[model samples]
Target: MYKHLLVAVDGSHTSENALDHAIGLAQGENAELTLVNVANPTEYMALAPEFLQHESYEAAALSEGNSVLDEAMKKALASLPAEKVHRHLLVANKGVKEMAQLLVDYADEQKTDIIILGTHGRSGLMHLLMGSFAETVMRETNLPLLIIRSDGEA
Candidate 1:
């Protein structure tokens, strides 16, 4: 009987799978879904990018990030009514605390009842190598979280 669901998405295949699952669940459970995309924080990109100084890649990358969030919103909203879905693109160019806290803050402001995330599914040798955003998210908050594995597995 959840009314509000906050979903963290990145526009990756894993995020797409999670979006489909979130939408389906929202449809079945009659809940509202919020699609969230976090921009590659400026911190991740050098302010004066070496590439920008030396090449054209920096501008291209910025353009790509701008398009990505909008594209994610379009794809996520395609599944539901405008009234039942909310889209957010946040830029936290710093620590995981900022990222996690911003989502948590948004959820609190929206009165969210749950959080849905698509796990990228880096496991075994790869899992240990890469860690997981979901794992970090899971550790940081008490919000109800639904972690969906990316497609292709059982």
Candidate 2:
């Protein structure tokens, strides 16, 4: 029933699972698929300057993000036409916004019917420390969300 499907991909197995579900949904519903990857350079901001400079960190992050998108696109093309699939490489604004917020805003901007995210399903201590992007988006967005977990433990 979706017209536009938005999926977050990070080149992880969890992300791959999410993408597979998105692709199946898009094919079954004849919807357009949008793949998004957000590269947040802020993760490295706390590192020593000598270890990784600002420019280098951002460049590496963007490069990796692009690679992730490219691979996802390749997989998508196997089942969907190039014209029906789209990809966006997003860079998180340092200190201004978090990655989850960026994804929510982009979904709003695109008027996507649903957001599909893959969760590592971390719990307890790890969950508290790293937090959950899927959970955050679920709390902030009004749209439908499909969460695919990498493991069943969660």
Candidate 3:
């Protein structure tokens, strides 16, 4: 029953699963699909009191992130209907901490009916280091979320 579906991807296998699921649903429902990737602004990492900014590192990371996302999108769209797929790349620090909310904002802007994403299934130390970006997104955003977990479990 979805009219517009938005899939938030990060080039991970879990995200690929989510993309696939979203695509299948879109194809079945004849819905439009939009893929989004948020490039976290690298400036915040250099916010320490004494450290100078690392321009080169940030630039390189941005470039790499964009390239990876582009490739992932290409792969995801290869088997999907051409007229139904759309893509957007955004750079915002808000996404890093509020991925679900960020997706919801984008969906609201696009009037999308659903948001799809892959859950990395991380816990303990790993989650402590990177935190659950997806969980935060899910908690803060206000949209129907279809989350596919890694290990092809969900």
For residues 26-142, could you state the per-residue lDDT of candidate 2 as single tens digits? 999989999999998776667788877436778867888999999999999999988989999888855323788889999999999999989998899998888888888898899
The residue-by-residue lDDT of candidate 1 on 44-77, one tens digit each, is 3555565454244434444555566577667657
Q: What's every prediction's RMSD, in angstroms?
A: 4.0, 2.6, 4.3
Tens-digit lDDT track of model 3 for 64-132: 567767876686577676778888876665536754456668888999998888888888999888788
TM-score of 2: 0.89
**Each prediction's whole-model lDDT (CA):** 0.73, 0.89, 0.75
Clashing pairs in 3: 100-137
User: Candidate 2: where are CA atoms >4 Å away?
Assistant: 45-55, 94-97, 152-154
Residue 102 lDDT, candidate 2, scale 0-100:
89
Best lDDT among the predictions, by candidate number: 2
Q: Could you give me the TM-score of model 1 versus the true structure?
A: 0.76
Give the local distance difference test score of model 3: 0.75
Tell me which of candidates 1 and 2 scores higher on lDDT. 2
TM per model? 0.76, 0.89, 0.78
The per-residue C-alpha lDDT of model 3 at residue 107 equals 84
Superposed by TM-score, candidate 1 places the C-alpha of residue 65 at a distance from the truth, in angstroms, of: 5.2
Q: How do all the candidates rank in terms of lDDT, highest first?
A: 2, 3, 1
